[model samples]
Target: MTVALWCILIAIFLPYLCTGVAKVSGGYRLKDNHDPRGFLDSLEGLGKRANAAQLNSFEVTPAFAAAVIVAHLAGNAELVTINVLSVLFITSRLLYIIFYLADLATLRSLMWFVGMGLIVSFFVVSV
Candidate 1:
């Protein structure tokens, strides 16, 4: 598969990665499985930040996926361009998560904008 397509797959699972971090760090147990949302909601500090990042990841993933797919189907942009943007988006997300965990709100917000801009770039490149 193309790198951009692979990025779509990665984007789909990124939220799970964030949630996993939250669960592992939040002291989530088997009992918590019955009320996972509640357990997640109770998290504080890094766990809470991770959970928030997970939610944000889920929120942006669809648009990122759609942008990549639309870019591919349009077949107007160079493959390298699409792949680079996809990689950059993933990088931005990773940085965003790191910043969130570190409680660096400004940097995290900047990375979020970067990711969104990359998503928009995909559509622009397809045009």
Candidate 2:
């Protein structure tokens, strides 16, 4: 698939990765309860951050996917623009996860902003 399409695939699965970390941390505890709030409340530090990242990933995915589709339909087919934003969004999200797990709030917030900017920039390129 094209880079843009691959990005859509990545967007689809990123949340799962974050959740996996959370679950792996919780182990049998989460496996038993499996209640969203309970499982989330049980986490601390890096696990909590993983859960937050999972939620945030869910929140951001739709717009990012939509933007990819829009840019695809816009017929510019400017793979360079699409690919750059794709990489930026993915990289920022990875860094966001790392920073969040490390409890570096400031850097995490910056990465969040950068991810948002990259998301917004996709719309810009679509136009």
Candidate 3:
């Protein structure tokens, strides 16, 4: 449960971190409606990606939480690996968001792979 709570915390803050980065990069104001096409388009894309990242976090977090819970119930020590991997997944996801916003497609893909690998690895180890 504690691990799950930490994962949730990371999930909640990851998108906000991306949003803050976008603002710093002059992407767009959170509430601004007056921007040029280029800025608006970029900002919209950033917002969408941020939202997508949040949704992805939600998608994986439950599987992570369930894995941990099952491990606990089964008295398995493998949950420790899953917990660590969950943290790694969250960190890699944040990196993915930054790379995505910077338009580093290859790096973003690599980071995404790392995150996905962690999630899949967790499931494999949990079972």
- Considering every candidate listed, which one attains the maximal lDDT? 1
Question: In model 2, which runs have C-alpha deviations exceeding 4 angstroms?
Answer: 29-37
Off by over 4 Å in 1: none
Error of 1 at 86 (Å): 0.5
Task: Give the Cα error of residue 98 in candidate 2, in Å.
Answer: 0.8
lDDT of 2 by residue, 1-127 (tens): 6787798889889888988888777663535665766777688877788899999989988888888888878877488889888878888888988888788999999999998888788777767
Q: What does candidate 1's lDDT look like per residue over 9-113, in tens digits? A: 998999999999999999888887999999999999999999999999999999999999999999999999999999999999999999998999999999999
Candidate with the greatest TM-score versus the true structure: 1
The collision pairs in model 3 are none
Assess each prediction's global lDDT (C-alpha) against the native: 0.94, 0.83, 0.63
Error of 3 at 112 (Å): 1.1
Error of 2 at 97 (Å): 0.7
Q: Of 1 and 2, which scores higher on TM-score?
A: 1
Q: Tell me the TM-score of model 3.
A: 0.63
Q: What is the C-alpha lDDT profile of model 3 across 19-83, one tens digit per residue?
A: 55545455455455455334534655665555455455556556555655564565544666756
